[model samples]
Target chain A: MDKLGVAEGLINRRKLLGLASGAAAAGIGLALPELVMAAPFEGLVERARQAGERQVVVAGGTGAYGDLVKKHFYLPFTEATGIEVVPTGGGYGEKLAKLKAMTSVGKVEWDVITLSIDSLTPDVTSLLRDLGDCAGLPDVASQGVDGSCLREGVMFDIGGGVLAFDKRSFPEGQAQPAGWADFWNVKAFPGPRALPNIGNPWWALIAALEADGVSRDALFPLDIDRAFRKLDEIKPHVTVWWKSGDQSQQIFRTGEVVMAMLFSGRAFRLRGEGIPLGISWNGAPLDAAFWAVTKAAQHPNAALALLDFIYTRPKAHAEFAAESFGSTAQRGALDFLTADAKASSVLQPANWSNIVRVDREWLAANREKVLQRWSMWIAS
Target chain B: MRAKPLAGSPFGGRPTSAQEYGPGLSLLLVTPLVLLLVGGFLYPVGKLFWGSVFVPEATFANYARILQEPLFLLVLCRTFEIAFVVTALALLLGYPVAMAMARVSGRTAMLIAACVLIPLWTSVLVRSYAWIVLLQRNGVVNNALIETGLTGTPLRLLYTQGAVIAAMTQVLLPFMILPIYSVVRNIPDDFVRAARNLGAGSLQAFFRVTLPLSLPGVTAGVLITFILSLGFYITPALVGGPGTLMMSTLIGQQTTELLDWPFAGALAAVLLAATLLLVIVFRRALALNKGFKLG
Candidate 1:
């Protein structure tokens, strides 16, 4: 949490660990002397072993993306710490329900879980433990981009709802949309376009507000009325209000929309499959998934160890992020990625600089109100 | 386990039928259904009612909120509007098919029946997605329009309210056709022939004889289509644009996205009440035509 030096941190950890001078070698700092400079907890592996913790249950997603998480993070953590990784995959709703059920009965099955702006709130906070300041997460604290570490969770990966256009419309050296304002200019960039109206409406709202000449810094505490007004202009042109990521790609592949807002990961996959797609990071609204520990976790130390292990290997992080067409918190991970791999990665300066973080905190509080308003606005 | 012999019993406890097939057997035959209804339908509905009124300390707030918000009422109105439109379209489009099926040769009737049943057999989700493929900007409909010079530019058809109505009608057409087909198929051929013989033109004979006799099936078909369309979720969500938001969409949003179970319960209850009210009105209207009461 302290952006200053390590002199006080070492003393603080020393007292926190309460390890005698003779046992200094086995303290938190020395446990991973080579990898972690300042591990969050002392003797995490030793404590987990003592606690008889072997498997860390996670509500990890399924399919190709889930496999990537397992290969890149879980397997290595198991190898390094001797804890088996069990990923019981389900959708956000299912997982949240399970979490609530587990906690209500005082027996949580999952040790760690994923969180997004959608599942982050709606009165579901008591289920997760507040990782105070995330000070123990040295990697996230030091190397992560701004707002990477928070009281509730640490961001494991980041994706964006980006402006992905067909390159044929704006070929090389041709004038291209630089931001949301450009995205809104149908006269200049004429084509049927797509925007998501999936359960998540905030992404479209952010894009609309940005197009309405609101500064990126002043976007939060959203001007709902202004956003809807801007959306009115683009509503006619959005031929497809795609409900899923697959549909988003399908619309583009079939030329349903020459220019549209699409999930960055889906856009990357389309480009990889030989589509002449161009992704502009202009005012891209970031959709990040955070790694959170449950309050009812049986093995809290084991959960922390798994989270800590994520930041240990930058190369694995890069590979996982690239394969999924997303990005990790660590800027260093981007170094290991290929040029083609970094095309949709937030590590690219164009994307990273222009990226707009979704105000998750605000969204969490006003989810129902905003959703009701959105339902009314879109339908009306 | 004997079925009670109550004269006004809706559950078919009349002594006349139960006595014919040993009372116990008649009651036994229906036990599984009774249990299923009690467990699957009634229990869940009871729970939903309880949650709507009881969650957060026995308050009517959930139901009140639904009434308070203009959004809920707007969606409810829109849902009814879509249902009415779908029912009207299905009737207009389906009556002819039903008539053909009823009057055609047996082999042709079988083929027409197959056409109606095939789409009904197909998953609603798949059918909805198929509509998207056909109506998409670069999809078959647009491509055909462009090729034939029907329009200069591809029309935005897929995500519009019109698309929703079209898809919903297509989906619900089978429901409308089968009922009318069955009744029309049973209408005596002599009735129309007799009317025509009695100084009636072909059109007059058909309208007076065929149409009046087929009214029962038409009423039944309208009831089925209207009820189903009121709760339509997938077709509207897939093909309908923002302006076409329906009641089920709002209910789904509350349950899944917001996890507002109480509010979702209220929404469901409102839909159920509205559907029941409409069905009752339809039944009362149908009742005026003596001996034409539907099950």
Candidate 2:
């Protein structure tokens, strides 16, 4: 237990960052826009109360994002309705594993889960109830951004792995890193760099291919060899191949590497600390995590009610995303954000265009092959 | 003085084999551990291997895939290589500390023991992160070197193969020390005195009489350390560079990332077999006689 606490404390710094942004979100999130369809959400709450579903158990990641979501969505939902919100979850990998294990045992424990875009992939998609055009969630269908409502789940959060650097190294007037190409340009950007060595090699691979001259839109069915070749040039210069998101920020803080590829949310968190960080959303992979109701959810009614509440309350969604440096699929979420929060969020109109869209079908099909090649190439 | 008593049965008095306790009592004594081993370890491992070969139907495709990909073999060899380095380093460093602990009386022995045991209590992640602080670009090691005019710039000390070996050795040193210390403590001073009385110098007494007797401990220590080192995942992943990939990391990617349990099981089965094979070879090679039966 002592060791577990130590491990959590070390890793929870990422969550701590989320908490910081949550506070910032709270500071300016006082002005939530009025909703015309507030009555519908109230009726759903009444229905949840009538159904005797007093609580919805949610499995999601912890830390600031967890804290912010609970504060902005879960806690408010609980207040508006009589239903209590119980939060439990782990990292994406652990969540997926738990889902697989629970479903296999025929004793699923969670009413809802926050999952990755890969949840929509074959095999995992079966664990989810096909919300079928999400016909039941009318507010979500009308207000969620295009493509947010999928057959398997709704996109709840969005962030991307973007190229981030210390602005001190490349002062504003001087040449600063603009994109993945600049991240590769060691001559112009003469400093130690960092890239992910975590299992999500596709981010680095995609960035490498982009740097190697592939256009962002056409980068799927990746040119793995070319990516490796480009990676080779930067290998000697890489000071850190960070494992966890927390470690990435720690390395930057310690001046281990002046520039590195970091999650956009994490980078914004660093920027929030006034660390003079610069982010380039250019050519970054558009990463998204989804929220889905388990097929065997004990409180399906409550879960549906909670989902509708999230979409209809755009201000809370905005604050949750703003403080967490993430993006929500709620269409009205943007209007509630401060300009600073908007600039930090990847879902912003200007930043959205620069993010390289992951071909989820290709990634799902080739995850094993891509990962094997990545491990081999990196080690060699 | 009466001859020093043999470091006899752990159960006290004369040594008696389990059969003397009778089957029922012995079974009762072992039931909990046996149940735990079977339930926690064997069942899951058995299920994993079952799921692996039977991907809906029995096939060796997972095993075949391991052979087809050079990464598995390469990582497997590298894992053994790192384990060997860590084990050797731990032995070289641990032997002296263990000898000191054995020779020292009362408070001194307690103090030395604390030095070895305190680290075991700390989490491995904390220790590895400590290494990061000491070896990073602007970390203590590099800062010290620069201040001392050893180098003009900071050396890349963190995230190298060297860092992995160093951190792992530090984490595992206690395992190497305790076994050797236990064995050395039991050896009578008379053994060394006997060698000295026979006209041997201290060095000769240590080498011929002491070291040979200590081989049982050395073998035991090496076996434990080597096997433990083989499966090391977190330390290398956190402190070692991507180039410092190991077999466990490969297995992890399969299970967590790829969700290809069968392939992960195959990789694990291969590693387990290799580890068992190595352990057997080591025991046979050491050939400790009598009570120190390695087999």
Candidate 3:
């Protein structure tokens, strides 16, 4: 019995090696320098068929974001490639924990994962495989996607944290809050405000600094002490420090706070629901969510193919952005998007100059210290 | 006559069916459970302690940082404060219900038991959300307050420290009630009756006799509720605002948000040690109190 078991294990191991080699051959065939420039998707489906791995698992954010990915990205990818895409929904933090556990156990179950700029720290990046040449997708470069993609991951969608206010509080014709300064001027806006408690506090800190009259250009290497001091002025007025997207939406829906620094996507959804919401693009911090493969992924080739497929497909990207109320990372994607969709996006041409870009690298490097200090400040 | 054979007939002083199996056999009977406890509980906790010292290279730096950091210390103290408040509130509210449960018989007791158990059966997340719905600015409570002319403006009730205490007390009230209920229900009715007959008033009888007899249950309830509340993350996070930062929230931020496992483990170790120390002190207090004896 023991000998039979050993023999079966050997056979299985040999089968795995054979399949891996086949996948590698297909990868090389598709990745040839000559063919790479003309049509990235050419022969990709056939190559996937020869690759032998039939499925790729994805870990992504839940709720509307998860649904959009499943409908517009994963389902389409599966239809084109014949490789089943299993998408698991979770918060970025939960996904990170699961990835760490799986990698530490010498078995990684996920091939692709969605990561926030804050979670793309050095420790997390170390566990991810460099996409090599796949990192430089031409579509991504032309789109002016957040630069963090050039370093560690592939940017898929761009969103921002905007100062969203209930229209009931700031009625249609009345003077409305224009920026962080007005958000802080409670006497002017005159209602409780909400900020995020989860993730890095860079958005809040930068907004605080900007409210304190710091220039947009001088926001990097944030003055943490001064920012916290500014925050202290508004602390007593903040009714909710929401930790989840759903919670943020609920707070707005329930009128828990008259105004909140909320994700633009959520604000759009709330407006669609007829919630009488207003979003301010001034001093809004643009945040991009990225897709990266794990180091120990069993299907790296398939994962890369999926990443490339999503990045290059403008129509799919547009649809994803529209449905998710986010902006696509492909330049051509904007052409495909409706004028209304374009107008609503954080990356709209008119709104672009007013928004501030969050420095991902700086935040990643100082995440620990910033988190400790933020916790202390919040408690205080 | 014949000394009543010591109540066991011809087998007086002999080993009964229960004692037929020796202590060794009894230990063997429970070996699987012991092994499970060691393997599942002790092993992971021991690993957590080891990880605290060894991760990011072997050192006591994590522990030292936690000790030196005012934030960590403050969070720990705040955690205790919230837990104590919850425990006290639960006791205050739960004692009367438990006393009523003990006093009542049949259908009424079951109804009260069902009332306590139903909430306990619900998920903590659902319960916290319920509190949010009830306590938000324009929620039911505020709407009622406004309609009744109690106050023109809605009071801020949801995200304050008060919300954390109230929600936690609601979630943990069952833990406080069940232990006290079980103990109180077992107390002989004759003791209270005898006190009443001995010319003591009803209030005096309860304070001198019923309360003392139920001290063991009160201790158990307080200890369980306090310890459980110390590790409460979901309820507090959901219902409370940033000001209500607890130790569990810090540890969660470290483990999940920051991915600083070593610091998280260190935080967990401190919380675990503090909980165990408190439990020991509580047990010692109970031991010193000769009036109450727990089974």
Candidate 4:
């Protein structure tokens, strides 16, 4: 048996050697220099043209905000122009990376990209076309927001990070915990908690400070270490550190935690799901996502047009927001929103009023410093 | 030279005639597979190595930065530490299971094998989530422990090193068991019986005859589990604490969050090199075991 096994091993080794040599030869034969394939992207664009169909690849078209993009932007625009919309999911940084990659290689993937204020309003100035300078658009400065709003991107919705809790868990009709200070009071609320794990320590820090009795208005030039220390105090009490919006909702829905700091849409969804969740609008961080035209868009005109058309129809915009739990950029859209939804919705004008608009300029200028600090905080 | 050799042989034997050319022909046939492996696996690995050394615009900045960062060093060390613990635990858990499967009779052994593989067959994410349910503060395990007066306070199990090690071992045990089971199942009972006949007790027979022979299987299992454990990202990330920053997670953050491609690539290159070195060491160790059959 040993001799036979030895013979078999020797045969297998010899066979392996033969296979290796043949594979090497094949490799040499097939190393025909790849002519940097551009055909797939080009083919999709060409097929759309040949079919007499306008093509639009809309980034950030996966979640509720994305669903709004589908219903309001793509569905209506496609009906108007006989175009097909390719929906893709990517946040601002991902979209920027992709846009940069495409422009570097000269193969544009999307006609339009959605970017949040935190990502788009900075470093992406060169990659975006000047939408404020575009003809027949609302001059944002005239409307009192500024050139910062009008310069490159169009804000389609007002979204923010908010505090939410399971109402069933605290149903004594107790004095409502107004802000982050109350959130930190474990003795009063006394249940497991959940917090975001975005790697951006801004919200976490902000919540920590708020919990430690720092007023919202006094939160500028944020003392990060103090905030971290406060978080350290509360860290053991937090049951789940959620990574995604959906994960936040799952934590809440499963009753895994009684209270959580959640994204607005996720909070809205939980409320809609009859999970006895309440959204506290106090000290919410307002960050708006903007629609921008990519520098390398094949249909730049169409992309801009789509962006404009989304803000034009007030009734449709309201309907979109109502369904999506997101408020539209249109001024009159809130009037069309139902009283019950407007009361509970963070997207409402009243809700938006309390939201502290994050100065992206400050964040953008200090992106590296902030991110490094943030990373330190998270791992620490 | 030996043209007149065999008078009674089926075919008259000359040296050239006796040396069949089939083996040489077979060697010629398998050259393509070699080329494929070289081109596919080796080429990419070569590229990664080159990327590590020759930073874009030609600088060793990435490597220098990696060395300078205490976090990077710490994480890398932790990754290996986690991998070692996971590998040890898997081996400890898997050996008995594999032995039982090897020693037990037909359907029962098969059923045990199925149970071993059921976790492997499940999605890794699903398994990690299941662990989350099992290890959470109010989870089943905690509830049972509390009810049984094991502890008054709910022991914090979720997002801990222990949880990560446990989950990782559960995930990787099948890899260890399957290879060991194959080797153990084939080991003839005669060796053990012979040992017993030589005045050795049952335990002595197992130690002398069975254990030495089963080293090949155990070596294979350990090597596989170690390698798998090193690259594990999702399981560790989901089930582990903040301090459990593994190499893959760091690579992910560098590429995805930090957008530092060169740094990410360099880290990846380091991981690949480490993996290769460990595998080679394992192979050499196995080769030195002259008593065990290589196959």
Clashing pairs in 2: A21-A323
Better by lDDT, candidate 3 or 1: 1
lDDT of 3 by residue, A302-326 (tens): 7877777676657767777767767
- Residue A234 in candidate 3 has what lDDT? 95
Q: Under CAPRI classification, how is model 1 graded?
A: medium
Better of 1 and 4 by lDDT: 1
Predictions' DockQ, in order: 0.53, 0.54, 0.61, 0.16
Candidate with better lDDT, 1 vs 2: 2
Model 3, B1-295: lDDT tens digits are 2233374222366655446787888889889999999999999888888899998689999999987989889889989999889999999999999999989989998999999999999999999999988999999999999999999999999988999999999999999999998888878898899999999999988988888878878999999999999999999888888788899988888877667888889999999999999899889987787544322
lDDT of 2 at B182: 87
Pairwise DockQ winner, candidates 1 and 4: 1
Please give, for residues B1-295, the per-residue lDDT of candidate 2 as tens digits: 4233366322345446563688889989999999999999999999888888997689999999888888878888899999999999999999999899999889998899999999999999899999988999999999999999999988988889999999999999999999998888877888899989999999988878778778878998999999999999999988888789888887887887667898899889989999999999888877745444222
lDDT of 1 by residue, A1-380 (tens): 32233222433443444343235456534344432344543456556655788889999778988998888888766655557999887887778778888888888889999867456663666678888887776667766767777677788777788899998878879988777888899999898888887767888889999999999999999888888889899987877778788888888788888888888888888987889888888898887788889998988889987776676667887878767877777777878888777666787666787888777788877767777777777777
The number of the candidate with the highest DockQ is 3
For B219-288, candidate 1 gives per-residue lDDT tens digits of 9899999999999999998898778889888788788767788889999999999999989988897778
Best by lDDT: 2
Better of 2 and 4 by lDDT: 2
Arranged by lDDT with the best first, the candidates are 2, 1, 3, 4
Question: lDDT tens string, model 2, A168-207?
Answer: 8888999999988888899999889999877788899888
